[model samples]
Target: MPAKTKEQKTAACMALAMKRGDLKKTPGTPAGDMAESMTEEQLVELCGSKVKKGG
Candidate 1:
């Protein structure tokens, strides 16, 4: 089996959380977590408005 990347692991964690109803969308907090300020900037810099194959 192929090793799971961090993105893949995070996706699986999110999926499991949703499956168990652990990831709820709080009305007051739009962040819904799933995001970090620094990481978001890094991702944007890396991807740069281009749609990659896997993304």
Candidate 2:
């Protein structure tokens, strides 16, 4: 599912990174929780679009 908000996109990206071993996952945090619950493919689909520069 695509992210509906900037915060959601950011969280998905962070969670994806955690899943890929690029970032540390801290329990009880949003990104960490997402990392545990969602698959890497799911997180990627959520934030897969190229981010525009400077909003």
Candidate 3:
């Protein structure tokens, strides 16, 4: 699925990273909450538009 909003992109990227062992999920925190607070630049820097944009 393509990701539209920053939240969706962040989620997709994070999921991919976790699946690839690039990132680890915290014990008791929602990844969405962390992604929500991230700056757009930071998000882009981390994921680099790897997540496809939705229509």
Candidate 4:
């Protein structure tokens, strides 16, 4: 899925942050939030678009 809004971005950010940390859970974080979930190809495309725009 694509992150089309700030809410989606925050959800994806939290999920990724949790994935990288050792904590089982984080307060105020939505455990069931998967609105921004995406496949590898989608991620690459999204980041690739940002990289181009940042240049």
Candidate 5:
């Protein structure tokens, strides 16, 4: 199932970001560059607010 909640959306986006190397791992932080600079639009684009039905 596609992500539906804010938490799920964020997790999905973070996973995608990691897979695409858009987000890096820092020694002390859970995320790197993308997290530090990511905008709301970027997150929404990465993980859509709603999943397309039967598509």
Candidate 6:
């Protein structure tokens, strides 16, 4: 499912970056853990289509 809040969408973006090796994954953190446990597709799904370039 898509993220329900901005925070959740942000987290998914961070996780996606980590999963794609674009960002360093800090183990034990929420986004890091999500990156470890979820697939790229899953992260993208959580990120949703409404994401924009800036806030």
Q: After superposing candidate 1, which stretches have Cα over 4 Å from the reference?
A: 1-3, 25-55
Q: lDDT per residue, candidate 2, 1-55, as tens digits?
A: 5566788889889999999999988879989999999988899998786544453
The lDDT values for all models are 0.38, 0.85, 0.55, 0.44, 0.56, 0.85
Which 10-residue window in model 5 sums to the lowest lDDT?
25-34
Instruction: Report RMSD (Å) for each prediction in the order shown.
Output: 10.7, 4.0, 9.2, 6.3, 8.2, 4.8
TM-score of every candidate: 0.36, 0.83, 0.41, 0.41, 0.42, 0.81
**Model 3 spans > 4 angstroms off:** 26-55
Candidate whose TM-score is highest: 2
Model 5, position 54: C-alpha lDDT score: 55
- Per-residue lDDT over 1-55 for candidate 4, one digit per residue giving the tens place of the 0 to 100 score: 3455555555555555455453354555552233234443543443333222221
**Model 3, 1-55: lDDT tens per residue?**
3345677666646744554457774533445444456554555455666545555
lDDT of prediction 4: 0.44
For lDDT, candidate 5 versus 6, the one ahead is 6
lDDT of 5 by residue, 1-55 (tens): 4545556566657745764667664533433444446564565565775654453
Model 5, residue 19: C-alpha shift (Å): 0.3
The better candidate by TM-score, 1 or 4, is: 4
1 or 4, greater by lDDT: 4
Alpha-carbon deviation at 8 in model 5, angstroms: 0.7
lDDT of 1 by residue, 1-55 (tens): 2213555444434434443466763333323343322244433333243323452
